[model samples]
Target chain A: MTERASFREYHQNIIERVATRLEESLPAQWQIPSSLREAMLYSLMAGGKRMRPLLVMAACEALDGNADAALDAACAVEMVHTYSLIHDDLPAMDNDDYRRGKLTNHKVFGEAAAILAGDALLTHAFYLVARLSQVHGVPAEQVVNITMDLAELAGPKGMVGGQAADMEGEQGLTELSQLEYIHLHKTSDLITFSLLAGGRIAGADEQKLEALRTFGQKLGLAFQIQDDILDIVGDEAKLGKKTQSDMKQEKVTYPYFIGLEASRGEVERLTAEAKSAVIEAGLADPSRLLEIADYLMNRDH
Target chain B: MTERASFREYHQNIIERVATRLEESLPAQWQIPSSLREAMLYSLMAGGKRMRPLLVMAACEALDGNADAALDAACAVEMVHTYSLIHDDLPAMDNDDYRRGKLTNHKVFGEAAAILAGDALLTHAFYLVARLSQVHGVPAEQVVNITMDLAELAGPKGMVGGQAADMEGEQGLTELSQLEYIHLHKTSDLITFSLLAGGRIAGADEQKLEALRTFGQKLGLAFQIQDDILDIVGDEAKLGKKTQSDMKQEKVTYPYFIGLEASRGEVERLTAEAKSAVIEAGLADPSRLLEIADYLMNRDH
Candidate 1:
């Protein structure tokens, strides 16, 4: 219980730090048109668990690197994630009315404004990274490499490709291999990138980088399977969303093909694999990463 | 007559080169899902004037920089331009049926695919810039600066801000200042970035950079005003689109406030100012830039 409490505190610390940075990163309202600023700030400040930024900060901390150096990147990843969520929830996409228990960007701002807000956020993410590279005095080579990794990972071959596949899959039958591809690219890719980016920023050596990459990939898969399980079993009120949405959407998920028990087992196995990779890499204080993995595997929401 | 024909030939050469490079810059079909790739390539390769890329090349050439070095940047700019066009033509935005005489992206592909394509292209543009920085062994610092410039110019404070203003202006009374703000940001900002990016790649002196900046602003305004004029008077077949779109949409345009003759006069004055800025910068062979400006001023299609 004590360990769990401490882990929660640690997670809270990272989240708070990231939240402050995010608020600071946005331009002043006076600097931009009121409506655009409001729309952008609306979704930006809507506040999720901020998992991506936490990964960045944690990765930096694990490597004994400067957490400050990772702040812009941390905020940048969150912006990208937020923008993806906005677009994904558009009338043309998932068409969700609520996200994080609040109205989606388009629900309040209208379709055009929502789309522009997403674009602004995405474009602003890179801008923030570039600006921070200068402000933090990080090497441009490192920043550019990081930027490339981000763009490629989030691009057509990565997240966008997965999304396109998912959309196409909806109109037809989906295979397990296809579902895995979708999971890997759509969700796992960005998660892996978040961790990899953190490790990269910390100047982790190649072996360490490889270990983080492996850990991230395993953890991401495990996380998604847990989500699949949650969709089936999670409390609607607690989760702040409808349960079994995938079933309603006819979206293929892990539990749909494999049994619920088997999906849970898969999550356990993947979580163990992630922890082992972290230990094998000999990351400084793997405790936090392990705790996060455990928390993800056990998370009800 | 001979000089005019040769100048036309020179512009055509740049346009052709840019078009080819734009094709090559996209990820191969194998790299991404065919549907996503097709959607992205469909708009990217859609034949247009390739003005932004040409500006990058011309600016680089004027500074005696290696054109090859700017090729990636040139292609990058076009990707940005294409992505903007895709989003701008969305039903939520302009709702245009045709662009470059072909069906808009959303018309051919579904809205979801179109949105994803634009997102993918925007992400891919940065990816290309990062890759080019490595492939060409350019200094990371320079690339980071360039990236920063691109992001800011295209992001909220620049292009996105302009778009937001344009959308907001549609609902309320628009003042001349508001219209200028929209035009400067929505259209001129990216154009300026293209030229400035070229100059930066060539390591131009501050004076030269300023000159390019000034030239770009003037040229962009002239180009937009000319577009306004064309929308009023251009032949449908030659323009490859229906004219009077601004009037139909009730978009605030230069010819709407200023008389048609005055708008034409503004284009002429701005074109001359652009040319003079180029010459004053002592750029080598200002002929192409001047010719481009004149072409923009005189173009009916």
Candidate 2:
């Protein structure tokens, strides 16, 4: 009956809804070749926090937009995020054996399948948006803008560019600005896009959109810094994969540039900034956005 | 001038124009990491026939649409084609060492950069389409539809799905229908999309659109079968990569399922069908499309 508990319930409900919708929306396995379908589904359905989709839905709700309208966009963002994870875990990239407490996609379905699956998902993201326009009767014009935004934020100037920076930076000493660039594009760009996409779908005004963008940027940075802290000091079982792997690979991280204590402080600062942006922007029932940021900052994994 | 000679000149002009535009449009190397940009440009700008972009431009022109309106789309299709080649040549895929008379992208840029470069190109394809909508003042709605069509044809339902089937089929004796499926999707989907995308941009009517689709499918199949024939009988210097490698890998091909002469016959049959479809559909100047089919059928490489 408490207000905070009700918001918590609302967040959890959206997470479950997103998970189910993602499963439902994917191309039917029998229609495509079984192996390819399985590969895409395996990585996609593998249990994760569903944080990106949750962000999408929350932003949609905050703008008093139809949650149903936001569903496909939420799933689309998740697909993009999941595809990135699959590619980033490939032997040629991070070469990780596990992800989200399960065998990495390439480990489960050969590297070729994994790569193709990632391609399929990335491609499907656009297709789904098109389907959204058709099925939901959203203006084709709005969908075009949404599609462009997603592509721009996830392309060279955004996530892919960041990924390239991260891969190249693996060999060099980590600089703060360089690390920021990597994190901003590789991690935060997609996350920021997810929130903005949700807001856009909901018809948020420019001022509200600006607030969502600011919240997304700060929260994404905070979330990534928390990931860095987890890599250094968190329990292995809770984290799913091995700890100290960033150190093992000599990958750049917040902990590498700043001490553990300072990194933790930065997360707190970013989380606070994210919350204030939501409040300043006067989002309806700001509780959910604020709660999500707090949860991201404090998550153990 | 003879019809063949004039057609050859037309094709040559488009190729040169496409190459210049592709080079001019790509993200400058300095803006992104040099290695990643270099790897992408290596495969992308490397000499090929510029077939996909040429198809797009020709389709647009046939519809009496402004050629300038189709340039970004033409470049976008080529980028997609180039990215597929880059990933397909990786150690995990076809494992080819040379492409278009040059060392493969991975050979020059290392596996990580090649993979990342492929990713960037794929992501950038959409970005370019979005930019097309913005820069050319194309209707956002049309662009969304175009984006969807491209994504659908190139996603699991089309190219990526075909690739998965191809990869999975590497272990088994390839069936005839299975081979057709692979060809239709893996090789033809993008080609089909390219032609259709150009037509769509040109405001082609439904009848013309259907004609373009049929023409694309037949021509794509014919083109791929020619590749199979060339792999068996092509001179290595002309083909740019080692010939007869399909047999070495035990990969299935048109030549593998049908006799060499029969495969050649099929190419002729498909080319005739492609040309007739264009003519029957009442396109303006179907000569260019008809001629392109003949060129594909006869090309040594």
Candidate 3:
């Protein structure tokens, strides 16, 4: 099998393990504010590929930290990602009616409830992070650093900036650089934070962490490009999200700017740079991260 | 002048100090996501009464912490409050068009920027907390504790819950207890956090902090009641916000259930309880706090 196929299987297995653990960590459904808890779980457990958290785990493991030690950090990052998706799909934003082939949170739970659910999830994300420092027996400094990075990435300088830029694009932007601006904020920043945070949790030093950041940076761009490619080529049923919505909305995308083929080439190039950086970090074991970098570009859904 | 009017002047002074400090801390305009920054500043600096932060400062002073050291905490709480107001006024939410006698954030900055500004302000609130720990020479553990408290107040079980309940009330809540439920989540929780976090910064002992929590609980309820009364009797120009909109919306308020006179009495009773707590804390100077609490019921706004 190609490196991409085998890596997909490996990531799939790890993500399932993490997801199961997350479910166990939550306050029992009954203890939660029934309707609000349901909305959080519905979006949280609906199960994306768990890419961000998986990055956190893989980076920690690569950096010689116990993957389990970073579990809550991993979960928190995923939770933040989930909350953004929930809010982003609200009628006032993307007005998305569906996500992951299921009705959007706002669609099922009403706009106010969905918005509150998103706020709750985001808040819970930090709660988990704070709790993790206590439970994982890590340095408070590490927890603080990890939390700060997560907050910044999930906040204005990162994903929120991207979302704003993306929203602006719906009004039709004339510049291709603006498309890149959107991608950097919307996708690349958090992906970069995910890997670096995992390393920090493991006590990875500055030099090593720097290399891993370069790796994550390239990987995120590749991943977003791959997303554009998938929307063009992958099966809608399998992907479980709407296809051609970008085109339909006249939203800017790599595919729209560079054409599908050029975007395809960019992903391939980014994948190579990403893999090389991981190899340079000397942080990975048994070629798994290198393999995963290859696989990120190959994800079809 | 009555003791209450005397106290109002004290609250007004504290309000001015906070406003001056916050505006001075900010560049006339910060360029990082300039539009969102503008939105946050517009809402936060738009002539707010500074009641929450004053409570925080007062509680800190009562416990032997310098009110100056509490600046970041004070500002952080206000930012969170402002973020909520911005979101609460969104087209997808309450959709009101005015705040503090000016256009709401969404009305001024466009909906997407408004949403983003709210998210940024919320995130920045935490950012400020983390930085405050350093700037104020607060112990790391104390800083972490305050951060956690701030997060909780803003999160699912606290302010967000209040917002959710408020939303549900629009669909019509039949039970008076449900309206209290709304107040607890929406108003009381943040108020509680405001006072509690202030004490935490000051290193208040458990007994004193707990007492202030009691004070805050009463004050929060009274504060909301006063707000309800203001909606009925407040002059629009004096309130610096739209005054007549709430009753027109047919939404519930404390006066809507208990009648205006009862709500006024409740505010007076609660304000007295709050003052007693400050005195009980046994601070070197309880004058400022006493002044603020004594005047709680008399604001035309």
Candidate 4:
């Protein structure tokens, strides 16, 4: 198969596996309250691009590691991602009524259930990571390291810190540096974490891991800039939400800071930089990673 | 010194150490946004009884383990506890304006900041546990175990599950069994986790760990019962919040179903049972655990 066709097949396969695992992630034995479980599953199963989990698996496979070993971590990252979305959509936060084209968690389940669901998803993410050692026989030391890294990336100085800065910026932040800082933590940190975590699970050396970090940083910026571009000129039906939300919220964006054409150029530049990083990493296979980068650059939604 | 006086001294000493550690927990190097940092520290350092951290240390000491070894885990449990309180007091949840006689997190920092602060705190708890292996040289296997246990107890099936049930119960839950389920998961689970985690840190064997679990469950129930009694009869000045607020909210407390005298009796019964379990555990010293049981049984706030 051609590289694009192979990448598509692999992506489809992983998405199916991830969806199944996520459905079964919260075991019945856990006896999570029925309503709470529903709320968590509602948003979790609503389905996004599953980009983070895919990154984890692709990174692991590129290292010649068994992709199955990274499955739990893949699900874990997605859970964290979903929880953030749910909380961000809360009335007190984004106050959005829709996400991924459906009613937001709070809109469907009420604010209280939505909050608990988000909290549960975040807490459960760690539980899944801890299970890596017990279930997959990944080394305890590696599991601990991943746990620590996940917390740092997702915690205050990482994603949470980025989010906090983003909210503060809503009060009229103008500096390009400030905007970059917000995106770096809020958006890019978690993306970097997915790559690094997958590499760690595969026992990649520091050099390879650093390469993955660089790749993730570049790709994340490109991905986010594309999002901004889409918000301004993309089809609303394809994007699955209202367009011009950034303008409505009076939120700053790359397209706003630099014009749309300049923003698009930045995406290409970053994606090219990201592809080079993976190529330098000298993985057993880098075709998939390279293709994913290219695909992200061209996607409309 | 008499047992009471020495117990008092030990309690005071641990509280001081815990307070200092919590103050320094979020290192300056993390570069957390100033406002988010302030919001997290506001709730974390506001100080309650520090009961959870004390339980961790006391359990470790009782096992003849170095209490110092359990210090990080101690701080971790408190962080989780504090985060829960912050989220629970949000406008969509209990709508409380005050916690521990201070303005609630959302009240002081706005709903968005409060939500993000709580998320950061919860994520950071796992970070602390993972640090146990790196910082204190706790065995990686042991750290992994503690991480799993903490997540389970604090996640959907444990504390979060309890909180969800409690919120659901607010719509006229009358069953005594439902109340017990809420208390068991919400309050008792974390208490049990604190003891078990401390035991694991001290390298307690399974039998001893089981005893700690039993001790914790009983103590946790007794503690919640006392909280119920105090809500109706507590001195607001000492309690640091309004008395009878539970009644005003129409919350289903132990006394609400069993009457004040019966609830008091249950606390005594549970405390006695808890003390017996610790005695049976054959620890290096059970004096502190026994004293704590008594303290909980008699505390007015």
| Candidate achieving the largest DockQ | 4
Q: Give RMSD (Å) of candidate 1 vs. truth.
A: 2.4
Per-model chain A TM: 0.95, 0.95, 0.93, 0.97
Best by lDDT: 4
What DockQ number belongs to candidate 4? 0.89
lDDT of 2 by residue, A1-301 (tens): 3544665677677778887888887656535788988888898888788888888888988888777878899889889999999999999988889887889999988888988899889989988877767787777767877787788778777888888888888788546998888888888888898888788878878899899989988888899899999998999998888899888877778987889999999999999988999899977766678878988987888
User: What lDDT score belongs to each candidate, Candidate 1 first?
Assistant: 0.85, 0.85, 0.77, 0.91
Q: Candidate 3 clashing pairs?
A: B162-B185, B162-B186
What is the two-chain DockQ of model 3? 0.43
Give residue A300's error in model 1 in angstroms: 0.5
Error of 4 at B107 (Å): 1.0
Q: Score the docking of each candidate (DockQ).
A: 0.77, 0.66, 0.43, 0.89
The TM-scores, one per candidate, come to 0.96, 0.96, 0.91, 0.98
- Fraction of native contacts (fnat) of each candidate: 0.85, 0.74, 0.36, 0.88
Clash count for each candidate, listed in order shown:
0, 0, 2, 0
TM-score of chain B of 3: 0.90
Preferred candidate (DockQ higher): 1 or 4: 4
lDDT of 2 by residue, B1-301 (tens): 3544587788788888888887877656435766777777788779789899889988987878768869889989888898899989999998888888789998988888888888888878887787767788777777887898888888888899888889988887547999999999999999999989888888888899999999999999999999999998999998878888889888888887888999999999999999888899877767677778888999998
Residue B287, model 1: Cα distance from true site in angstroms? 2.8
Best by TM-score: 4
What's every prediction's RMSD, in angstroms? 2.4, 2.2, 3.7, 1.7
Please, what are the lDDT tens digits per residue for candidate 3 over residues A1-301? Answer: 3544466576887788778876765666422356777788889898878888878888888877867767777888888888889888877777888888889998999877887788777777777776666677777766667666776777766788778767756768788788777777688888888888888988989988887788877888888888888877888888897778777777678888889999989988988888887787667462666767866777778
User: Which digits, one per residue and each the tens of the lDDT, describe model 4 over residues A1-301?
Assistant: 3545577788898888999999999997877889999999998899888999999998998898767878889999999999999999998889999888899999999999999999999999999999999999889999999999899999999999999999999999888889888888888999999998899899999999999999988898889889989999999999999899999989899988989999999999999999999998889888878988988999888
